[model samples]
Target chain A: EPEVTQTPSHQVTQMGQEVILRCVPISNHLYFYWYRQILGQKVEFLVSFYNNEISEKSEIFDDQFSVERPDGSNFTLKIRSTKLEDSAMYFCASRGDPSTNIREKLFFGSGTQLSVL
Target chain B: LAKTTQPISMDSYEGQEVNITCSHNNIATNDYITWYQQFPSQGPRFIIQGYKTKVTNEVASLFIPADRKSSTLSLPRVSLSDTAVYYCLVGGLIKAAGNKLTFGGGTRVLVKP
Candidate 1:
């Protein structure tokens, strides 16, 4: 089974520095998403990307966050400036188009553990 | 999407079946019930999803009554490796860009010996 792959499984960055989390979604998948989970907290949606544009985003996806599909398979989430609160497990997920009857199962990557100090 | 309410935790034995129920009284007509499992520090893995009636997959079964206001995830003959956090989510009909899965506080299942 094809799986989503995220780079830099663990990242440690200084506060106020910029960080970019990289993900390669399934090759044939069309829709992409980013979610985060603080330690001991529920997973929270960050943003969704389709057709090279953001389709939806949550309140937490503020000015500091941006997602880009720089290539066919790469979906990247960039945080302009990092904060302590931004430390969490960031996950990337993708699903085939609904018309495919794939049931839209979000294939999530193992996730990147982000830590800001 | 309807907010889901579920037990915070459950305890089960190694050879027993475990049923974790979730309530989504305000589930919309277009919404579906989906469950995911997560281990410590890893992303959630899709378990099962159902619209109505009973749907069973290789790993678990989802039972949704006619009312669709609630659903139960049944894990039969669980083992110690089955210990993890189980999340129940109610979301709009999943599409290319419309499926935003909101995970609530998951039910932590502790499978004991």
Candidate 2:
């Protein structure tokens, strides 16, 4: 199975600073997603993207959060200004186009540990 | 999206068969039950998925009753390496991109040798 790869296994940034997490999803997959798991908390969905636009987003995704598929191969999550509450493990996941699969499941990257001081 | 309820944790000894059951009382007709396993500090990995009846994979087996309101994930002859958090998710009808997937608090399985 093709894997989704995330760069910078760990990142630490000062509060109010900007950060970008990069991910390379499976080559043939068409949908992308971002999820975060705060320490000891359930993993929370942040957003989903497809067709160069956001398809759906959770309330946790605020104005400061943005996603981009720059140059087609890379999907990125950018936080304009990080906050202490932003500290968590951010995961990138993708699945192939649904038309080809009925029991669709996502393939996830290892994840990026983001720490905002 | 259907809401899932599962135990917070379970303990088992190596070589024992383990089953974690999840209940989604309001599950939709087209919803599918999927299970994922996540080791410490690693991303979730797919285990198995089933719409109804039983679906078995090399890693695990997903059993859904005829009503489709509940499902159980069975891991045969568990080992210490089988310790991980198991997540149950029920997805919408689209079964594809744009469908919302909400993960519930997972069942933490502790396999001791």
Candidate 3:
């Protein structure tokens, strides 16, 4: 089975710095999404991208955050200025065709553990 | 996106059937009930999904009533490896650029030997 791939399995940076997390969604998947889970907390949706643009985003996605599918196969999430609260495990996911006739599901990456000190 | 309610935790022993129920009273007609499982430090993986009636896959079984207001995930003869957090998501088939799934607090299952 194809899997979503994320780069920099572990990233550690100082607060107030910028960070760019990269992901390679499964080939032939249509929709892409990013989610984050803080330690000891539930997973939270961050944003969704499709057709090379952002389709929807949660309140957690603010001005400091952005996503782009540069080069068609790579999906990247960038945070302009990192903060302590940004420390979490970021996961990238992709889904196949959403037609109801088929059972569509999201395939997630192992995750990129981001730590801001 | 519809909100989902599920148990916080459950305890089960090996060789026992474990069932986790989730409620989504405000689920829309186009929405589908999906479940995901997450082990420590790993991303959530799809377990099962269903619109109505019962759907069974190699991993687990999803049972949804006629009303589609709630769903249950049943694991047969769970083992210690099955210990993980189970998330119930309700969102799919939306007519838009993308259908974003909403995840609520998952049910943590502990399988003891």
Candidate 4:
């Protein structure tokens, strides 16, 4: 089965530095999403994207955060400045057409662990 | 968004049925109850989903009451490999509707030998 793929499984960056987490969602999926889980905490939604634009975002997704679909297959989450609290496992997910009478399940990538020191 | 509550942990024996229940008092009409499982060092995996009543798949079963205020995930003949954290989420399919799924403190099931 085709699955979502993310690059840089582990990323370490200095505090205040900018970082970009890249993901390639399932080839045929249309909707994409980004979520983060601080160590030992529940996963929190960051943002959702469709049609080259942001559909929804959480309070944690502020000016420092941005998402882009620079190409057909690449979906990226960019943090303008990283903080210690930003260190977490970032996951990228995608889902196929929900109108197809299916349950609209999300297929997630292995995840990229971001660490800001 | 509907907030969910579940037990912190559960213990099950191999070959026994395990049920994890979640309470969602504020679930809306359009919201769907969904369950996901996570193992160490991996992303959450979708297990089952339901709008109402009972829904079953090869992996698990979901039972929702008429009030839709609560739901239960049933795992049959659970084994040691079934040990993991299970999360319940309520949300919509609209990507723009702030459909961010809120994962509650999951129920960690430890299936013993």
Task: Give the per-residue lDDT of model 4 (tens digit) for B21-86.
Answer: 999999988889999999877889999999999999999999999999999999999999999999
Interface RMSD (Å), every candidate: 1.5, 1.5, 1.5, 2.2
Screening candidate 4 with a backbone cut-off below 3 angstroms (N, C-alpha, C), the clashing residue pairs are: none
Clashes of each: 0, 0, 0, 0
Q: Give the TM-score of candidate 2.
A: 0.97
Can you list each candidate's DockQ? 0.69, 0.69, 0.69, 0.57
- Sorted on TM-score, best first, the list reads 2, 1, 3, 4
What's the true lDDT of residue A112 in model 2?
A: 98
Q: In model 3 chain A, which range of ten residues has the least summed lDDT? A: A96-105
Off by over 4 Å in 1: A102-104
For model 2 the local lDDT of residue B21 reads 97
Off by over 4 Å in 3: A100-104
Clashing pairs for predicted structure model 1, backbone only = none
lDDT of 3 by residue, A1-117 (tens): 899999989999999999999999998988999999999999888999888889999999999999988787999999988999999999999987866454447899999999999
Question: How many backbone overlaps does candidate 3 show?
Answer: 0
**Candidate 4: which stretches are off by over 4 Å?**
B93-98
TM-score of each: 0.97, 0.97, 0.96, 0.94
